[model samples]
Target: MKNASRLFLALIGLSLVVPVFADKDPNINAIKARQGEMQIRAHNLGPLIAMAKGKMPYEPKLAGQLAGNLKLLLDLDTSRDWPPGSDNKSYPHKTRALPNIWTSYPEIGKYGKDYATSVNELNAVAGDGLEALQSKIGAVGNTCKGCHDEYQEEHQH
Candidate 1:
């Protein structure tokens, strides 16, 4: 009975140590941070897209605010959130970023510049009128789609 009690105590001690010694993913936090940023982008862009589509009534004040939010997001320095080896291939289903995002280097920079251009244009005209918003919003959406098509895996429904 003493031996059985000692064995149980030993097993409990091992369980406590095992987790501390476990190989935890180092890139998980970076992946989550980047994902959160994208979610915020989508949250800000969604209303503007809806208004542009005429599905939602275009309120100039709201249009300007949402576009401003997207433009503000562009100013965030997110390089750390996109560290190498944090892609979906490395982290699997935890992320949708493809390995080519890192492998392709500055090739992706053009897409970013394009996105910025689109967002800036949208921001300038979003408060002007619904017609103005419609004209520039497509360009912004296209820039987003361009990057996602190249770097992000298709999100499964």
Candidate 2:
């Protein structure tokens, strides 16, 4: 009985120490670089999305190129590749990312899905030709607004 009690106590003590001694990721630098790339690509995405929406004067060829770019960006595997904090950290980058993104991760993911859907819709319009592109531009813009409303900072345009 005494041995059992002592063993239990030892196990408890080890559990307490294990977390404190656990290693932190040493790959922060690599993570930051990947995050930076994500930000650059993400920033460019807005304009492409906008172009596809025909917010600017429409050229079918330009719209097609923008659609391709948007698809490329959407396809990037962020699971292991995207860095942390390079885009969202408060001081260094003036990112519009809302604090709620990390807090409400599920909702943020939903916004990502919505963004992809909007991009796909825009692509379809582009493929259909500029005549069908006008209203869909607003539809894509709404996705941007939805994401920004929840996940980004307000900007005065």
Candidate 3:
């Protein structure tokens, strides 16, 4: 009976371990590449935000271009297969994403939704001119900060 019990436990352990070593998903790699691209686009939003904050001179034409770019980036589907290294490996560019992001994926998705909403609103106002958009900048600015505060490292600028 003891031998039978030991055999049963060993099988159960293998059942759990087998999947971890299963073939890696190609979709995950594609998703990781897309995510890397979005990170670069996200970084570019800073200069536009700085202009709105009056840290730099505001150019309505440039603001419109930046706003359009932001809209495109925010509209991307960022959720794809969880990148492999995201679970355990930390890269130089990666911020230590909270583990809860994996457990609570829906909540993490809300941050993207919020960003999209803000970008849409910003784009509407920015289309007219910088002055028209300046007042609404705070709402959009907070959306960027809201996600980065949790998911990204602090930028010097």
| Residues 126-148 of candidate 1: C-alpha lDDT, one tens digit per residue | 99999999999999999999999
User: For candidate 3, lDDT tens digit of each residue in 93-116?
Assistant: 443344455666667678878878
Off by over 4 Å in 2: 1-57, 79-94
Q: So what's the TM-score on candidate 3?
A: 0.63
Please tell me which predicted candidate would have the highest TM-score against the true structure. Answer: 1
Whole-model lDDT values for every prediction = 0.92, 0.63, 0.69
Model 1 root-mean-square deviation: 6.0
- lDDT for model 2, please: 0.63
**Candidates 2 and 3, the one with greater TM-score:** 3
RMSD of each: 6.0, 12.1, 12.2
- Among these predictions, the greatest lDDT belongs to 1
Candidate 1, clashing residue pairs?
Answer: none
Better of 1 and 2 by TM-score: 1
lDDT of 3: 0.69
lDDT of 2 by residue, 22-61 (tens): 5254234444545586566566556655655556666677
Q: After superposition, how far is residue 57 of candidate 3 from its true place, in Å?
A: 2.6
What's the residue-level lDDT of 128 in candidate 3? 74
